[model samples]
Target: MPAEKKAYPLRISATVLEAMQRWSDDELRSVNAQIEYVLREALRKSGRLKAGMAKPMVDDKPDT
Candidate 1:
């Protein structure tokens, strides 16, 4: 079975969004992807992401 995705509404100021775009491009990722990646990493580092938590949109790629 495939997983489903849920969309959320996010609001950002223009200046903050511009900075996010610049950093996202520098990191070779879309703004959304960069944000998801960072959040996931922080959760993992903080031990908040356990082995059986609800799946999120981050790193849905297959192992290569």
Candidate 2:
């Protein structure tokens, strides 16, 4: 079974939120998803996450 994601309430300045929102739109990801992606990238760069640990599970869904 895959590990479940935990939710946390985050507080950030409006300016940062606005910037993140724009980046998220550009990346075609929800703001929450983009934030996770950024954090994951940083962790990988810092060597906190191993290559295997950084790989998110791919869900196979049929095209409509």
Cα lDDT over the full model 1: 0.72
Clashing pairs in 1: none
lDDT at 43, model 2: 99
Q: What is the C-alpha lDDT profile of model 2 across 1-64, one tens digit per residue?
A: 8868888999999999999999987767778887888888899999999998886543222244
> What's the TM-score of each model vs. the native?
0.64, 0.82
lDDT of 1 by residue, 1-64 (tens): 5456567888989998898889887877788877777777788879998745535555543454
| RMSD list, candidates in order | 3.8, 3.5
TM-score of model 2 vs. true structure: 0.82
Among these predicted structures, which one has the highest lDDT? Answer: 2
Each candidate's lDDT (Cα)?
0.72, 0.79
Q: What is the lDDT of residue 25 in candidate 1?
A: 79
Q: Name the runs in model 1 displaced over 4 angstroms.
A: 1-3, 51-64
